[model samples]
Target chain A: MSRSQQLYEAMILDHNKKPRNFSVMDPHTHSSHGKNPLCGDDFYVYISCNDTEIEAISFIGQGCAISKSSGSMMTEMLKGLPIQEALELKESFLEMVSTDISPEKKKSLGKLKVFEGVKDFPARVKCAALVWRALEDALGAKSGETSTE
Target chain B: MLNPNIRKQFPVLKHIENGHELVYLDNTATTHKPLRVIERMTKFYTHQNATVHRGVYGLSQSATDYCEEARKKVQTFIKAKHEEEIIFVKGTTEAINLVAESFGRFHLKKGQEILITEMEHHANIVPWQQLCIKHGCTLQVAPIKDNGELNLEAWKAGINKNTGLVAFTHVSNALGTTNPVQEMCDFAKAAGVAVLIDGAQAMSHIEVDVQALNCDFYAFSAHKMHGPTGIGVLYGKHELLKIMPPYQTGGDMIDVVTFEKTTFAVPPARFEPGTPAIAEIIGLGETIDFLTEIGLNNIFHHEHTLLNYANIKLKEIKGLRIIGEAKEKNAIVSFVLDDIHPHDAGTILDTEGIAVRVGHHCAQPLMKRLEVPATIRASFSMYNTLEEVDKLVAGIKKIQGIML
Candidate 1:
């Protein structure tokens, strides 16, 4: 596949076109805005956690396929998962885009592994990591606008 | 017409990587330096390096002469009447800041207004906003039409009894819309208001005559016109510079010093302080020679042809919408391809070794006026060719096929 194709895989495109959980979670417990000023990518991630588990997660914004699709896949993975496991996934997801990940770690990422191609395009790294950064902030003790500058 | 051989002067046009020749389309952001400029800068560093103005040594005298000679070139390039009107700055941003801090403090009063247009780059916008906050002044904006043209009536009306100063860009870096500078200056003159033009985009693409425009202040960067980076200029009428306070205080700008009191120097020296960017100013001197040898009118015509051709060809593509359709624009074309985001298009284009800018272009207010979150900008210069623009069109089509 071409390098462009690698970044925009069919699965990623599908997620981008019909983004899952692409909405505002009403009565949400946590919400954070993410923006990449260089690329003009802006998004808001919403999460509703009950006790120790995330009951719902959603996102809505305007951005490139890499950012929107990554947000969509993240919501799909974190829904119904324990908060600890979701945080672990976020850490691994950030790593997968930034550096080379082993096959074992790559297999653990599942559909999120599509972003491993992001390591090749340094400019687009922030695009793929925007929502993840927002999610990390939303899931943590802090909540505000996050910038992947 | 510009000689097509001008392309040979820029070495970056020959750049090849990943088995693809690079197609540079971001001239509005900055242009690549020519061989003469680079060579002259090397010569300055190698043999002519010394502190300017303060040194009594022979080498330092030669360096001061070269630097001052460059100042003369700038004064002549923009048709300023006196060399003392020219102030060496870091770049366009710093130039604007210097005026906003220095001129604003000296001239403007509380509740007085600073009027600017909707299409200004952030470099021109933020400093005034900060000035308003700092000095209890009011900031007002002139409107632009849906076609990205400045609304002349609104702009003329915007300068009223309360308006102290007006600032606008000569050629918009994002929209490619050239303002009616002389007409705008005439309006400000009729209103008895001062004006400062952001000429960063105009320095390379247009023949700028500050005297002809009759504007009080003009600011621009050297790198935008193939000079070295880290150097820029602010051209203020000498009378204003003489009255206005110094922006920074240090060695070169000082005239006298005492234990308790110190006095400053004259116009240009008063504005410029500390050690200057010596080699870059020397490079700017060579950049002026390079541009003048090719001729600004000829370069304007060559880039005009490229803009017209690219506009016609790109508009023919399906789902491509061109933005900023100003009648007086030059050297830039901004557009959106289908529903595909500009960032995605930019990345795919980079894969083909094409460099284009895709974003709000430091003109978020202009973007809001144009109703686009972002856009893909293809800016041309004298060195660019029609064939390179063809590559840009093909790259856009490829992006649509892959992305849409």
Candidate 2:
């Protein structure tokens, strides 16, 4: 049993049973849908933003455990963070999972480090990144901001 | 029957991975080519390679003969009434699109219906969807039962006088469900609807008799049947072919071109526009001969035993849930572990020199119906054995242990 496999199992269980923020928001300031036509992974992210801070974040869609759980974890991490900080966190998350980053820095990404294992399996990277992409799209469209990562 | 020493006929089977013998379970995607098929392609390129059907030289005659002979082989393999019924296309995807463009344009009307099942591959579904959208027709799908089998009653109910065509897969690539295509065709005929069977998965596993099935059109790829890729056959009835317009227009399919008007050639040639996949077509001929020698009955029995063994062994795993447990199935087994992601399972198996497909398998609508994001699919070919099945089971157990 690899450590990566252990982490993936935990993530899948978390996503399947009590997914984090797995509900639709009443008044979402931003929302976007993304789909991977090749593997049929589809999901939507809803962001509730007020002025400079993210009031709440939720996702309501169906996808693989990786994407779903990633969405859940992203929501849990991004809630109450300033919108600019949330966008910055998305960039840092991208760099953390990308293969170009050194392993030491990847391990330092902390809770976001669960995704480092996905880099070894190229195919799953898309699933793990689906939520991030949706979040990026939603935030970009809402704030008229472009991702620097 | 392939030569008794058939293992030697495939060079790739002899390959070793990670110090372990290779156990390929991805035949549903594309099969390893037999040596005879390889040799035929090599020989074509080495000795008689030339542009076909236009040159008056010796090379042209040889190339044309090999190309036409390959078409005849496909004609005989599918047992089509006439050789002209076999039109060489890129593969099953292109063949379906050809039908959608030509026959679909001619037969389908506004407000008509196109009936397909939930088990259809995207190639079978998307083409019809495009046609329906183009012609103002409706695309209706017959849903599957809990056991992953098509609801025949629902299929019958879906077809009526307004149904223009009923297209379905002969075998479900994801579920391994062997659809009752002939029976479905009979019902469609009674309903006055044309039927097209996507034999991409079926051609490799079972003996296909288009005439017996009485489908209006049958499509299959060479790569799935131990042949080369980039080549496939579209078998349509001669009457239907004659009525359908050309899918693509170009050189060989033209009869006489005048400044004012142009006339087209007949049937097979009319559908094939540009230069075909000549070398691959010849290789497909050799692949058919290899399968004919092995006899589909023996191949079918061998795969059935393997599938049953795999099913029983897979059932013993504590947290593994096999998807698509259809009563009538081919040699595919799709499953999802209790906690592990399918991609993780695939990666773990690959490390042990076992290869399997992991994903939705281009059946998005079916996935939506099944309520699964993705599944790990282990598909078998005649070349696979019980020993490989054991490796697969062992790999899955290891995956479960690691995840748990």
Candidate 3:
């Protein structure tokens, strides 16, 4: 098998078995629903936030392994970050998933760089981006707005 | 059976990927068009393309004649009672929506019910759901048997005096199960309910006779049947179409425009508003001619043979489960590997130059009932062969070997 396929399998298995932050948040300050109508992948992410930090984060819904794992990883990354920092992380994350960022810049992406492999499979990119898009929507980005870059 | 050389007609079959021959199995989504259909549309745009039904010149007359001739061909292809009963639209989705807006809005009442089967595509389900919601009616779905066949007993029990309409697909796109549309239509007729059969999946592989089936409405898209996109046909019973109100309001459908009021044209022209898909419709007519020349019965039999060959070969693999096993089915085979996700299977097959569809297939409710997230679907067209089925089996084995 190819390296891309091996990485994808590992990603999917990890997502299915030990999904990160798979729970509900109390006193949720931020919540958003994301749906991929084409594949019927739907999920909601809840983030409990204070002025300077994210107290807790959780996700609830069903999707493919790529989506679920991506959401899990995102929740872990967002916890303890300030609201502004989390928002900036979202931008860097989007840049990492979509091509056009330099290799040196991408090296700074950390664990989120696991999704760089998704660029080869265009259809699966939506799976990885679903949760991130939901986070943007929760932050007041209008519906139907897509960040293709 | 179609000639083996028929594979050469579709240019996309020769498409090479990763230094391997492309084995396309996604026909249920859309069939690759034959070069004849492409050439017909090209000739129309290049030599004789013009606006239809308005100008007095020769080119305008030719365009109008071509458009109307396509309508006549559609009427004959589906065996509609009259040429006037066939209304050209944008595709199957638009056709169903037109029926819901015009017919459902005009006739359906508060206490009435719209009966549908569980195997319907979303295009068949959503429009009626919207109509029922808008008109204060109930939408009831008939159950499917474990083998993916519609529960005829449940269908009979669902139909009552309060049932206003019955809409369903003639073939399940995901399962490939062929529903007994004629029998269902007869039952609906006995209950005084109108019947609409979504022929999007069936139109390509099977011969459709709207008059023989006695369905109130039959909808299909041209692209599914080796024709150009943006063109479809909706065949309605003349009496029902005459009674239903116009769907869209625009020029060409009106007979006279006075300051006080306007008079509309007949049934088909009333339903068809704005400039129609002229070149595409003309290409659909040529596609119909091509199918007729080759014969639809030959295509149906050829696909059945291929389906049988695929079923027998696929059953040999251990830990593989075919989703739907209806006895009366067309050329689609949806299945799941015990441990592999459908996306993984599709990716592996795609790497081997075999294209298959993997997802809910626009039937989320059915997916829920079947108790699976998704299934890998390999649908066949008339041009496919037993060798391609062998390739699919080989691909499945390769996927299993890797995953297990």
- Which prediction has the highest lDDT against the true structure? 1
Residues B30-65 of candidate 1 have per-residue lDDT tens digits of 899999899999998898888888567998999999
Q: Model 2: runs farther than 4 Å from truth?
A: A1-29, A40-65, A72-82, A102-108, A142-149, B1-5, B15-20
Write model 1 residue lDDT over A8-61, tens digit each, in one string. Answer: 888888898899999988889999999987778899999999889999999999
Q: Judge candidate 3 at residue B149 and give its lDDT.
A: 94
**lDDT on C-alpha atoms for all candidate structures:** 0.91, 0.84, 0.86
Per-residue alpha-carbon lDDT of candidate 2 for residues B1-404, written as tens digits (9 for 90 to 100): 22336678889998987567899999899899988899889988998799899668999888888888888888888888899999999899999999999999887888999999999999999999999878899999998998899999999999888999999999999999999888998989877889999999999678888999889999999999999989998999999999898889988898899989888999888998888888998899889888988888888888898899999999998888999988899999999898666876777788788989998898978888998878999998888888889999999987766555
Off by over 4 Å in 3: A1-34, A43-61, A75-87, A134-149, B400-404
Docking class of 2: acceptable
Which pairs of residues clash in candidate 3, taking residues 3 or more apart in a chain or in different chains? Answer: none
TM-score comparison, 2 vs 3, better candidate: 3
Q: After superposition, how far is residue B97 of candidate 2 from its true place, in Å?
A: 1.7
lDDT of 2 at A135: 85
User: Candidate 2's C-alpha lDDT?
Assistant: 0.84
lDDT of 2 by residue, A1-149 (tens): 55445446666555655788988887888887767766656777889898899999998776556677778888988999898878877776776655767666555455776776666666677777777788888877854222211
Q: What share of the true interface contacts does candidate 2 keep?
A: 0.31
